[model samples]
Target: MKTILITGATSGIGKATAVAMAKHGHRLIICGRRTAVLDTLKEQLSSITEVFSLTFDVSCLQEVEAAINSLPEHWRTIDVLINNAGNAHGLEPLSEGNTADWDAMMDGNVKGLLYVSKMIIPGMKERTSGHIVNISSVAARQTYAFGVVYCASKKAVDAISEGMRLELTEFGIKVTNIQPGAVETDFSMVRFKGDEERARSVYAGYEALKAEDVAHAISYCVHAPAHVMISDLTIYPSAQSEPRTIYRKQ
Candidate 1:
C-alpha cells in the first residue's frame, strides 16, 4: 500500500485529507500537536488503514525534526507529504495588528512547513519518487485588510512550492499547490482570536468552500498518474469572485 504523511492532521483540511486517503487504502503517518486528537484519529482509523501518529507542534523546529526522526521504521519511507499545518492569527489591519498574531502566522504557516518538509524530502529524494502537496490559500494571491501577514505566509508557501517544483523536478518529486478560497472551519475563528461571532460574520453571505471540497482536490492530486503533476489548483465557490468577494443571498 502507498504511504502518506500528513501534517496538521487534527482538524480542517488535514483531517479531511487523512480520512480521504485512508479510504483509498493509504498507510498514513499523521502529525499534530495534540496527542489526544492524534490518538483518537488513530483509533478511529485503525480498522481501515495502518496509521502512525506523532504529536509535536509544527511551529517548533526542534519538535518537528525530533518527531520525524522518532518515527518508527515502518512509517519512515513516505510516498506522499502533505504540508498542511498553517494558521491565520488575527483579522486586524496591519498598522494595528498584534505582533503575537503575526508571529503565530509566520511560525506556524511558513517555518512550520519548511521544518517538516526538510525532514521528509530526503527520503523522497533517496527513493527518487514522491509527491508534496502544499495547502496554500487564495490570500496567497490576493491581499486584504487584516490579512497581510497571513497572506504573506501563504505567499511564501506559493513561492516555496514553485521553488520545490523547479528544484525537485529532476528528482521526480511532484509538487502540487492547492489554494482554496473560503472554508467553514476554525480558520476564521483563529484569525479573529477566538471571537466566534466575528468569525461567523465573515461567512454570513454565501456557502463558502468546505474542508471536504479541498480534501477532494488533494485526493485527486494524490491519485493522479506519476507523470501527471497538478502544479496549482485554485478553487472558489461559484458565488465568490475573488479572495475578498462573496455573494451572500438575503
Candidate 2:
C-alpha cells in the first residue's frame, strides 16, 4: 500500500479523501490545524489502514517544516501528497475587500501549498516516484464578481500545478490539478464569515457536489496505472454549467 499525506484533513474534501484513500488500504498521514479532530479521524481510519495525524497551520512555514520533520522516518517516504489546505475568507468587491482576507487567501492558498510541497518534494525527488494532487477550484477558470482574490488564488494553484508537472515529470513524479465546482462544505460558511443564512443560501436552489464526489475523483486519479497520469480534472454538479452558471428550479 502506498503512503499518502493529505493536508487540511480535519474536514471537507480533505476528510473525505482521507476516508477514500484509507478504504484503498493506503497508509495515511492526515495533517490539519485541529488536534482533536485529527485524532478522531485517525482513530476512525486506523481500523481500515495505518494512520497518523499532524497538527499544523499550513499558512505557517515554521509549523509546516517542524511537523513534517517530526514524522517518523518511515512516514517521510510519502508516495502521494495532496495539497488541499486553503481558504476563501470573504467575497467582496476589490474596493471594499479586506486586506486581511486577501492576505489569508494568498498566504494559505498559494504560499502554504508551496511550503508543504517544499518539504515533501525532496523526498519524492530522491525516490523518483510519487504523485502530488493539488485541489484547485473552478474559480481558476472563471473569475466571478466579488471573488477576484479568491479566484486569483485558485488560478495560482493552477499555475503551480503546471509548474510542478513540468519540473517533476522527468523524476517520475506526477502532478494532478483538481478543479472542483461548488461543493456543499463549510466553504461557504467560512467565506461568509459565519453567516449561516448566507451559507445555506449558496446551495438552496440546486444540488451541489459533495465532498465525497470530489474525493472519489481524486481516488480515481491516484489509483491510475503508473504509466498513466490524469493531469487535470474539473468537476461540476449537473445543474452547474460553469463556475458562475447554476440552474435552479423555481
Candidate 3:
C-alpha cells in the first residue's frame, strides 16, 4: 500500500480518488482549504485505510510550505502526490475576463501546483521513488472562445508535468499528467460563477464523464508496477470527441 497525498480532497475528482485509493488499502494525506469537509471525508474513508487531512489554501505558498513541512515524520514520506486542486473561475472572452478570475486561475492552477510539488519533491528524490499525478484538462489541448485563461492555466500544467518528468528521471520519480474532458462536477458551476442554471446547461443532453471515471484512471496509474509508468493519459466521454466537440442527443 502506497502513502498518497491528494490536494483538493474536499470534492470532485480529488475526493473520489481519495476514497478509491483508501479502498485499495493505501494511506491518504488529504489536503484542502475546507476543514469541515476534509474532516468529513477523513471520517468517511478512515474505516478503509489510514487518513490524515491537512487544511491549507494551496494558492498561498507560505501555507503550502508550512502545512507539508509540519507533517509528522511518518506522513512526510509521501509515495504519491496528486495535484488535483484546481478550478475554472469564469468563462468569458479574453477582452471581458475578470482580473480576479485570471489571478485565481494562474495562482491556484499553476503556482499552487508548483508550490505543493516543491515542498514534496525533495523527499521523493532522497528515497528515489515517487509518483506525481497532475490533473490537467482537455482545455490544455485546444482553445475555446471563452475559456482562454482556463485553457492557458491547464496548458501550463501539461508543460510542467513534462518538465518534472524529465528533471526527476535520474531520481526515478514518475510524473503522469491526466487530461480529462467535460466531467460532471462543480467545475461548470464554478466556471459560471455560481450560476446553477448555466452550469446545468453545460452538462445537459449528454452523458458526461463522472468523477469516479477519472478516479478510476488515477487508480490505474497508481497501481502500475514499479518498473512501469503510465506517462500521460487523456480520458474523454463517449459522447465527446474533443474539448470543443460533443454530441448531445437532445
Which candidate achieves the best lDDT against the true structure?
2
Off by over 4 Å in 3: none
Model 1 residue 250 CA deviation in Å: 1.5
Task: Evaluate residue 129 in candidate 3 and report its C-alpha lDDT on the 0 to 100 scale.
Answer: 90
The CA lDDT of each predicted structure is: 0.91, 0.97, 0.94
> Per-residue lDDT tens digits of candidate 3, residues 1-250?
8999999999999999999999999999999999999999999999889999999999999999889988999888999999999989887788899999999999999999999999989999999999999999999999888989999999999999999999997899999999999999999988887899999998989999999999999999989988888988999999999899999986
| lDDT for each residue of candidate 1 in 99-184, tens digit (9 for 90 to 100) | 98889889998999899999989999999999999999999989887788989999999999999999898999999999999898
TM-scores of the candidates are: 0.98, 0.99, 0.99
Model 1: CA > 4 A from native: none
Give the better candidate number (1 or 2) by TM-score. Answer: 2
Residue 67 of model 2 has an lDDT of: 96
Which clashing pairs does model 2 show?
none
For model 1, the local distance difference test gives 0.91
